[model samples]
Target: MKQSTALTIATGVAAAAIGGLFFYARATRPPVINPDVPEPAKPVELARYLGKWFELARHENRFEKGLDGVTAEYALEDERIRITNSGCQSGPKGERSSASGRAIVVDEGTNAKLKVSFFGPFYVGDYWVLDHGDDYDWSIVGEPSGRYLWVLSREAKPAAAAVEALLQRVEALGYDRWALRITRQG
Candidate 1:
């Protein structure tokens, strides 16, 4: 090819690369800290964190389909949050499945966020406490990417008003409410 033709092709490639980088940077950037995560005045006592927590709502995703009555049971095991999640399905009993994971607090003092590993070899995700009630009656949880969310409570179901309020809070954080799924409790 001629030198001018080669220069034009190289320029095109560089422009495309720069544009791609700009778009990705705009899309995936994390939220700037408005304020450091508040320290729990009295840390969440892990003993009460145990027991069945029904999935009152979640950010919509394809993986959890037909999994409405799901519950995540948390217990302290070896100083880690041992989690067992099980729920009904639209398939055979043999097809119904459960996942076990562990959560370890990333910061020792606040106990506000944790890293949970579900895959072997240990892939972890941020477990941010987006919102919580003083009585531990209801809580909103999400990850950094806004890819996962869960509305949890000790009761089998939460009031419609509570759900609406939680949705508003998440939306205020710039997450999408239209994509939220209200999971049916057992």
Candidate 2:
């Protein structure tokens, strides 16, 4: 009887220790810092913005790791935007993987901020258009949390000058330009 009681106490102590560690980790985790960066002055025209956009550069994330020839296609469906993202796993000619999601414009006036959901209505993520070209040839997508950033273009391969300029613009917005991984397109 005494041995069983001691075992029970040990188990309780172990559980409490684990609970304490989890609480400590949660409390000490760094929060996302969003700077006072300006959104696009003009609203995005859904019609002009539709179609395919090739990934030029992006802040490294696990979702698209080991991906190449990444492209995101947008299509208008009623009042929502359908998002189709595809990429090659190994290289430009590697195995292809795709994910589909839907986005709703958060503000009708600007059409710059959107809430996208891939897993039904429960899980949603932010999709903000920070900047874009007048002709919709290029765009910069980011979140208000400043955790993710992507540089996209209409062309599969954009010119060096254009990419340099885009990187400069991203840097000006207080993002870590060095964290951007130039996507491989073939």
Name the candidate that leads on lDDT.
2
Question: What's every prediction's RMSD, in angstroms?
Answer: 7.0, 4.9
RMSD of 1: 7.0
Query: What CA RMSD would candidate 2 show?
Result: 4.9
Question: For candidate 1, what is the TM-score?
Answer: 0.69
lDDT of each: 0.72, 0.86
Clashes of each: 0, 0
Residues 16-133 of candidate 2 have per-residue lDDT tens digits of: 9999988985665334333555575568988898999999998767678779999999999977999999999888899898999999999889898899998899779889888889
lDDT of 1 by residue, 31-56 (tens): 33222333333455566667778788
Residue 18 lDDT, candidate 2, scale 0-100: 95
C-alpha-based local distance difference test score of model 2: 0.86
